[model samples]
Target: MKIGVLMKQVPDTETKIRIKDDASGIVVDGIKWVMNPYDEYAVEEALRIKEKKAGSTVTIISMGPKRSVETIRTGLAMGADSGILIDDPALEGADCYATAKALAKVMEPENFDLILCGKQAIDDDSAQVPQMVAEFLGMPQAMVIDKLVVSDDGKKATCYRRIEGGAKEVLEVDLPAIVAAEKGLNEPRYASLPGIMKAKSKPFKEINLGALGLKAEEVGAKGAKLKVKKYFLPAEKAPGKIIPGEPEDAARALVKMLREEAKVV
Candidate 1:
């Protein structure tokens, strides 16, 4: 079995951000980058699948600038068989669709039996790439997967999906499908010292857009179907007021505040 795992390098959650003067994007300077937190779950799940299937190979794929190789190595250290990085200056501002399209093209010839990704990248939180990639590859996709079971023959996959309001949905999907992993799917394993050393020798392939047969205008901002008009932070929220006294009094006060000061219903 061949399992393809998609990971991304994103600004660390704790990193302070500065918007560019033109609002085209955030300033990269002084920003620490790390693997997307959710993608860790995807990598862990793929490694578990490979462990269960003796001949299965887990390949981690990342798309970003040169620094993304560091993120890919992180996955290799977590036990993925190898890593592929699609690095090019043209891919700098690729949106979700372009990203998925490029990744689909890169893996189409690789012929993976299954694909996995994080439900969403923390930086953008768009939660759209998995579905876009599935569509581009013409495969069925299961999102927010918290549990997964592959058949002995590797022809089908049964999964439990986490839904809104703490609900769970069960799905039985065929092979050659994509799955977006959610939290609680599995605890991600830390990279052991030995594993890290072994990863240093793993095959890490880097290819440019030309190698992928993609032109500069066919990806990144030029090919992007969606556009961001402006980027700005939300206004600071006002501090809350406490309602004192008994339940009945507090309820009345809340109603008054909503009807007058807050003006809601």
Candidate 2:
């Protein structure tokens, strides 16, 4: 089986984001980057699948600036067989559709039997790329799946998708389908010392638009239909008010505030 896992590099969740002065984007100068937390589950799931199927290979694929290589290397250390990084100046600011287009273009020739990715990247939280990639490749896709079972012959995949009310929707799709992994799918493993060392020797390929057979106008900012007009932080919340009196008095005060000041009653 050949499995391809889509990966993304995003700002660490704990990092404090600051919008750019011109509102074009976030300030990246001092931000620490890490693999999208959701993608970690996808990587772990891919590794598990590879272990169960002999002669299987897991490849990590990503699109971003040069710094994204670190994210791919992290996946390599997590036991993916190889890594492919799509890096090009023209790919900067590529929106979800363009990103999916570029990734689909790259993977079509590889002919992977299965594709997996996180439900969403944390940075933008768009949650659109994986489905778009599946559409571009003309493959069926199951999103936010928490459970997966591949057939013994590796010709089909059964996925359990979590929906509202804690219900799971079971879907079975033929081979060469895409799945967007959600949290609770599996716990991601840390890179072992030996694994890290071996990752350095693993096959890693970096390609650009030209290599992907994509024209400059077909990707990146030029190809993006979505545009960020401006970014602004949410308005600061007011401090809470404390009603300190008898319980009965406090209850009455709270009710008053709810009905009058807050006007929610």
Candidate 3:
């Protein structure tokens, strides 16, 4: 079995973000980057499958700037057999649609039996790539999955997808399906000293827009159908107010405040 896991490099969740002077995008300078947290789960799940099935190989694919090679290395450290980096300056500001198109183009030749991705990237939280890639490839997609099992013959997948109101749906899908991983599927393993050292020598492949046959107008901000008009942090929340007095008096004051200050009565 060949497992294709989609990984992404994103700004660390705790990193401070600053809007660019021209408001074109976030400032990348001095910002720390790491693999998307949910993507980590996907990689771990792939590794688990490979452990269960003999002769299975896991490959990691990522599209980003040159630094994304570092992210790919991280996956290699976690036991993926190989890594592919789609690095191109032209892909800098591409939105979800164009990004999916580029991935579909490259994945066409790989012809993987299973594709795994995070439910959503932490940076954008769009949650669109897995579905879009499935659509582009004309394959089935099971999203936000917490459980997954491939049949013995490797021709089908059974998974449980998360739904609204904290519900889950059990589904059986044909082979070559895309599964978007959710948290709690499994506990991801940290890279050990040996794994980290070995990752340095893993087979790495890097390609650019030319290799993917992508047009200049098919990527970056120019190719994005959705544009950001403004980028700014949300306003800080106000401090809580205290209602002081007897229980009855506090109740009356609360009613008054709701009717006048909050106007929700």
User: lDDT of each model, Cα atoms only?
Assistant: 0.92, 0.94, 0.92
In model 2, which range of ten residues has the least summed lDDT? 160-169
Best model number under lDDT: 2
Model 3 lDDT tens row, 43-114: 999999999999999999999988999989999998999999888888877889888888888888999999
Q: How do all models score by TM-score?
A: 0.89, 0.92, 0.89
Top candidate on TM-score is: 2
lDDT of 1 by residue, 66-138 (tens): 9888889889998998999999989877899999999999989989999999999999899999999999999
| Winner by lDDT between candidate 3 and candidate 2 | 2
For residue 50, what is the lDDT in candidate 2? 95
Clashes of each: 0, 0, 0
Superposed by TM-score, candidate 1 places the C-alpha of residue 93 at a distance from the truth, in angstroms, of: 1.8
Query: Which scores better on TM-score, 2 or 3?
Result: 2
